[model samples]
Target: MFRVSLLFLILGFTCLSCKSEDKNNVGTTEENIDALLQARYTKLLNYDVDSTAFPRSYSPEKKQIKQVPSKDWTSGFFAGNLWQIYKLTGDSRFKQRAKQWTAFLEKEKFNGRTHDMGFKVFCSFGNGLSVEDNQNFKDVIVKSAKTLSTRFNENIGSIRSWDFGKDRWQFPVIIDNMMNLELLFEATKISGDSSFHKIAVKHANTTLKNHFRPDGSTWHVLDYDTISGQVRGRVTHQGINDDSSWARGQGWAINGYTMAYRYTKDKKYLDRATATADYFIHHKNLPEDGIPYWDFSHPDIPNVSRDVSAGAIVASGLVELYKYTKNDTYLNYSKKVVNSLKTEHYILPKDLEVPFILDHSFGDWSKRHEMDEPIVYGDYYFLQTLLRLKEID
Candidate 1:
């Protein structure tokens, strides 16, 4: 018999209390939702200690990984999310931690040399600390923005990725870079400079023209020759090769374009966001729990691993898309994914040992060690999606 007991338990824990309110009669009230989110936020914040500048992923159940530098980019991403929550709740504790995090990054000499510098510095220093008008942070953002702007090559019309062995090849621009373009845009806003905005627009246009496929899916990486400004190769960082679609890469494109639209108000960006989202939603390969296999084109299904992190990121992007279109379908889809994430497998409830909502996120396919780990990005986006929903309510 299909067990109804487990189903009842899931439903019982899934439905959070909905408080009565006059203004928002359709769903839960904003204040009530904020209170629930605040409780979760408090739990997450309490885990941080002076020994570490930011919250660790979790206390390991087994032997712990060696401690690295306190200023890693992954930790910075979570701090950025926490800063967003602080903005929503107006909590001083969140602000203090955020400040401490930025100070650590500033002192650490974070040069925008890696593809992840945008995710690292832009999210934390640019988005998080900028709101509070911290001069040190403002300078940090300006310096990073200048470094990123300098990375723009007029020949290829896209920012360079890394200083790999050889500089002859123009290298490739990956979809992940979209998250960093906001840094250039912000720089333009702060300095009244058009060059930064121009570079960002060109890069966006180049991605739109080359990176995306007709089916709305995108390549994980695209190599463009610097001298001639021509395409060289398209490859996947997480799949077998260029032909496969890594689910999270697609998620990044969807979320990136949605955010790009917010900055530029370009209808084309929205079109791309919706197109990428459509490809993800319409794909028949999703597991019964709503999470996708790590690679949609992975040869096997039942044997292939799933990435709940992809689901969490895409679910958050879907909510942002809904805000732009005000489409009920998008909102419903976002809610469905969130419900699955909270009830199906990964989410640890209030009484559970862990605080995160999703786990088993794969970071790289080359080495499978990252599989089944609680990725910081997954937790960040999950919190972001829930916070956005609260605002809508």
Candidate 2:
């Protein structure tokens, strides 16, 4: 029952009547997407949310909305999306809304329980800063990076990605952890602290050595012995199984290393991004529509639900990758995904359907399931992809 249903998408939507792509309006692609997202977000604003609770996901079938506190790893995405809308539309309403939601996450600068400060603080405050100069946002980002750095183990040459799995993992790091390095890289540029950059490079190097397979697919989790600096084991705790390529994990590498390459101008990171992107592009299980099954190695491929979130991540990353490489491959492929995702089956039919935009985002397919649901990160990445196209593509 893996799901991101086509039902809600096509059945009751206003935007479906809109053209999927206006080749003539290549100049207005951002405008079309922005209007649709703005309407989608208007519905979200009308929902009975606490504002601070942070809308995490919604199940259209159950008509339930899921919210989390600021500490949740996903806390920043909602605000980040708001910031992006403001950036794209230059609408003061979007800016004010972005600020309102992003303000709730300022306290997260002090949170050290996990290594997701980048997702929480950077995506929110970082995007806020991008909108306008804010000293407060700058301070929060620097301190959050410092807090994130606290988790880095010089012995292990990587940041510890988990806290609760103490018995199961001595020093665990996930491919998703590659994300925090982006924030750290930015921190160095702002603070002129090479220490932050060194930590980021070391962590990425450690991950490059351990997390990836020969075929360029990445393992979800890797545990290391800090003292020996040796990988204790590799496993896939959040995917279909230990041996499978989790869909989002692939998205992360494609997105993460693109950021790495952008910041460092490092060809190695670009090459790494290319490797993972190629694997994903050619994977046999990839649907013709450009979305992927929750796991590339799912036991039953076409039968499993697609993770539109993964498609969004890869699409967004490819747009950025296209800018760096000037390769039409990434641009053309990303545009195809944008066209595919525009269908009523993937995106919400209208603002009235749900507070969220896209559905069928899979957070996990193992225990503690988040299958075929709307996820905040999915909304963020998809909107982000649109914004990237607006700016540079």
Q: Which 10-residue window of candidate 2 scores lowest in summed lDDT?
A: 7-16
Who wins the lDDT comparison? 2
lDDT of 1 by residue, 254-360 (tens): 88889889889999999999999989977888776567888999888768878877887888888989999987867777777666655324543333333343456
Residue-by-residue lDDT tens digits, candidate 2, 1-393: 112323211112222223453432322344455455555666554444355678888877677777789999998988888788666656576688788888889888888898999999889999999889898888888998999999999988999999987899899999999988988988888889888899999998888888999999999999999789899999988888998899899999999999888888889899999999999988988888788898998888789988888999999999999888888988877777777766555656553455687768887766656779888898888878777776772
Kindly provide the TM-score of model 2 when superposed on the true structure, using C-alpha atoms.
Answer: 0.90
- Judge candidate 2 at residue 384 and give its lDDT: 85
Clashes of each: 0, 4
The alpha-carbon deviation from the true structure for residue 177 of candidate 2, after best TM-score superposition, in angstroms, is 0.7
TM-score of each: 0.82, 0.90
